[model samples]
Target chain A: MSDMPSCQFESRPRRIVIGSSGVQTDFCSTCSVRPNSICSVIEPGDISRLSEVAVEAIVPPGRGFIEEGAPATDFFNVTSGTVKLFKALPDGRRQITGFAAPGHFLGLAVSDSYAFGAEAVDTVRVCRFSREKMTELLDDFPKLERRLLEEASNELVAAQNQMLLLGRKTARERVASFLLDQMQTGLLPGQDGNGGRLHLPMTRGDIADYLGLTIETVSRTLSWMRAQGMIEVGKGYAITIVSIAKLEVLAAGNG
Target chain B: MSDMPSCQFESRPRRIVIGSSGVQTDFCSTCSVRPNSICSVIEPGDISRLSEVAVEAIVPPGRGFIEEGAPATDFFNVTSGTVKLFKALPDGRRQITGFAAPGHFLGLAVSDSYAFGAEAVDTVRVCRFSREKMTELLDDFPKLERRLLEEASNELVAAQNQMLLLGRKTARERVASFLLDQMQTGLLPGQDGNGGRLHLPMTRGDIADYLGLTIETVSRTLSWMRAQGMIEVGKGYAITIVSIAKLEVLAAGNG
Candidate 1:
């Protein structure tokens, strides 16, 4: 287990998000989502200012946040739950384009309008900051600006990886990649690596939409994995990876 | 030409690299590269400091400027020519991930290292800035940080769109979309009121790599476009859009 680097974080970058109930504690400090989040990079001063300028908003499941051609309002950093960015074809076919976690930022646009729609996959919490306030922050802190730019570059890299998935990978390969990616992202809490178990967020349909396949295909692939004894699935999106070695092989396009 | 929006302007942002002698100009007013890039949301004061810290370097085609896992040293905004960012798979299958243009930033990463290598697609000129300088600039300039963040979001959008192409669209549709993306991105700069016309950088092989197809497929698709009178190919990489209406129709994944 130690052979695999701990990906325990990448979910909750920032701990502050106001729910209807009240302010949440600093869940980011020891939560599983801290390792790769920008929230970890924010200094005390930055966090203070961010808290001052940001608003916590609840995103109900299936609710729309940003849609294609909509004006860019506030940029969002998810604090909890999952979100999917997707596009619809002229024929009404839709593609789940990206999956955003708690630490990930969403709906940022250099142009005035967004080019994609951001929709919540589950009941989610997010930190929203005004574009203007963010601009002021950039002028005051060059390191933050650099960090944001670097973040953008990372986003592009991930996008390119997605392109490879869409362009080159087979359906089975895509499914394997998705499962591995979800596990490696480790946005959720609990499930200490007792026997290589993992958690999932979206359903079969969402996976199908993201991977450009049908729900049936997703089901078939999962069934195939089960038959191969590579994984054991339980209720509530729980998965025990019986063999990550084989899954990694599939993600490498060997499937 | 009068009808086409001219993106050219006097006094580009700034240069990141120190050496610019051999750097060819991409436009009359714009140097080979801009120092500040689109993320100039940072303050003029910070910009000046970063200008002192950045290093400029030039590389000919087929050479790499940044490797995938090396500590992030420099970031760049492309001034002239093309820079391709790509990820190398475990088995060494190169995924032509992205192509950077004039005024576009390069070597941007959220982490200390780049996920892909930056390779020159042409005799490229670049403005280089240290990541530390970028950090300072971003920390000081929230606007710049916001801009960079938004730009990254755009790249993510582009990647998702590319995913739709690779996963859902046919080879012909992929070619059409690539042509549209190239032309719209200003990679092909000279078109008149009649329609948008521009040059295509990289060969069919490059396009195939980017689009997740074989060179044979790319060439066949181009031939098919010509036979259908959708576009006219000229000397070098010049291409005239014989039918924008048909092109957009195909580009929307309708054809």
Candidate 2:
């Protein structure tokens, strides 16, 4: 991990006192992302067991939590905000493999070292679990293992799609596909949807890295899309899909 | 699946009769790749259970057995030969995601349809199991599920590395990295190794697709490496590594 900032444990109390209903709530119980995360497979009765091992931490914007090639001791589940997962070469060239959103799981490698580094794209909150504790949980809950396999399978599919994009897709097609995908992720549960409006957290450089394009190319493409009336670029990290049909045509490689 | 030959069942008997000792051997028990594959996690006593659901089939060279966007009905374990997994654009631009060698597991998607297509690179043998049957095995054998998770994790790591290669590496670096990876895979158990000599199963076109380069570029890079005394391009698909140190330097982006 870098010296930027570590994932510091939240200073709030682990147990919260409910107002007047006399109801007791634990960390995992009130977590908004649990329903969409791997924790959803755990029964309500066993949620306390999960809470016992999980430590909620907050990572400030642009802070790196996981370093590539470092010891794989911990796993993370994003509870809020976006995280960018990437692999860098010795020459300092980088490739952003994926942007992990809330409810996304990190550190799924079988190797003893991490294959990629993870940094907060925005102010992020995550639940951390040690490898030994995670193994114990998997042994105790078969459903959790199955759920993880499902998650890994889904990630593998996404990786394949990314390979196709990086290897074959045109710059315009890649940008359009990325916008559409962001829209889809924004529509997921626990996310605030503002119709076609999107609040992108990463910079244009990050977008270029993810799409295997230069920053100038990304900027030019966005300008072209705006001029074509396919999208409306708004102030500071905001973009609106003006014409979904037109973007879809470009994303499908027909533009 | 395409109009090419399907993975047809082998004509050999399921049970082999040993001479003199009258010992009975099932298909999985005699499988050459079983010891290194996910099947290794299954108890010896449960071998018959696996054999009951597995159907051995042969796929001829260049046969497409798994089609992109087709219903994913079964999972396969390669026992011999190599298979290329790929995704194609609507305009017919293809990206060979990764090559699956012996002991590799395939069709791990959580979706109802395959995310990519798979084709045999040479005469290949595989053990096929229906998704329902595989699920039953996983339910009955927790270790099997754990093993599958490990396989998926390893594959995820490989996919990330491939994304890095495709998105960031130069053409020469990409080819160098590919040669080193092939050498490592060749060194694995059940694969034939003749010093540093490699009998590449796929064509130059496939290599170009996998490395995100054109056929001309791939050829030019190989010739450059050969002239630099880093490798020796032999007849047909043969290529011998002349100096691993040189290739490693190039692969690490220092050449």
Candidate 3:
């Protein structure tokens, strides 16, 4: 067995504190999702140093956290709420690359400018760190660097998976795949109470952008799936899979 | 500025040597694309250590270097030739995620199994390292870790760009985008000589897979581009952009 340091991160609630910016901030100590984020890989002794450098901010729905083509100055970790990352063509056509949840990191880039725009699907909270300070922290903490690398790897994998979804899958397959993915990530409310019940934080247009389909096609496919007794939709946002096997078959493009 | 230790790796011609396993190996000292790869971020003193753990292998055309769902045992650095990375649905529908050129790294994953399959587009040479050994080396080399992180970030950007192509762009726009991308990467032949002349290393099927188009659609679009005086094709694999501005307009979805 390698002697590499490892941490098992889980989320819990805590209290908030004030920041250097004179605002009431949720310090690292109070971050319920710390263990579920890159911050979890750091030694407990380093938590104070991390909190000292982090700035907490809240974003209202429809507000952009990061704009595409802007200079990338900071890295963000979503502490709560959902954010959709997208790239827009000059003609206003948008393609959502991925969605960021509580544990997901945002704004890691290879170049000087952000490649995509990040917007809040709902009211969102994020911990922000300047790139310069974050690099220093990474240099000081090897475990943190490793954890960030792992996160980057995860992002790459997810991107490639989305490529498959966009490039090959049919509309029904895409929607089914998206539901299964959300279910696996526990993005659905009362997830444990149901088999494959899911709560979508994003809108139908958001889903259309994500799945590379028109909103009408997305709705039509969902309706068809419902007619086939494969899923049940509630309140236009909640989804219940009545037949997971069939859904999986469709997702695999074998149905 | 951070005082991170960095290396100036340069590839040179050298004879193969026998390793501890009694197998003839292409040592790191002779790698032709070392300076162009992530290895350049390591110190010169660490090159020998890296070579000691690496096994150089040659892959023939049509052979897979990495298979989806297989145990993720090794990481690869392409020293020569092009490789296509892809994911396949159960019914054999394939989505080509990205193509790897010389100096590109392959096989980084978030799970124990590879998320995609990598196949040689031509006769390919690669430097292979066990994942365990590479992780240890990463722990020992901070600059290398930073380099890997940067590569992963770059990959995410590329993947997102591809997502935009697959999701939002039309067939002509997709082909134009592909050409512009290759031109930007200097993957085109006579990149500095004449116009945007390209040498396609992969087949029409590969291009079709990458662009999420039927082979017929790809061929028809190429013909359309030619008729529009936007591009010129020669001897099948050679392409020259006759009108880059128009191509860019098409790529932006405004044509």
Where model 2 places Cα greater than 4 Å from the true spot, the runs are: A1-25, A187-195, B1-24, B187-195
Ranking by DockQ: 2, 3, 1
Model 3 docking tier (incorrect/acceptable/medium/high): medium
Report clash pairs, candidate 2: none
**Residue range A1-255, candidate 2, lDDT tens digits:** 124345333242344446477765567988899999999999999998888888877887888889898899999999999999999888888899999999999999889999999988888888889999999999899999999999999999999999998988899999999998888665434444333777889999899989998899999999999999888889899888888888878888764
What are the per-residue Cα lDDT tens digits for candidate 3 across A129-165? 8999988898898788778889999988898889989
Model 1, residue A233: C-alpha shift (Å): 3.1
**Least accurate stretch of 10 residues (summed lDDT) in model 3 chain B?**
B1-10
Query: Per-residue lDDT for A148-168 in model 1, tens only?
Result: 665667677677778777766
Q: What local lDDT does model 2 show for residue B175?
A: 97
TM-scores for every candidate against the unseen true structure:
0.78, 0.92, 0.89
Model 1 Cα shift for residue B119 (angstroms): 1.9
Better of 1 and 2 by lDDT: 2
Best-first order by TM-score: 2, 3, 1
Candidate topping DockQ: 2
Query: Who is ahead in DockQ, 1 or 2?
Result: 2
DockQ of each: 0.42, 0.85, 0.69
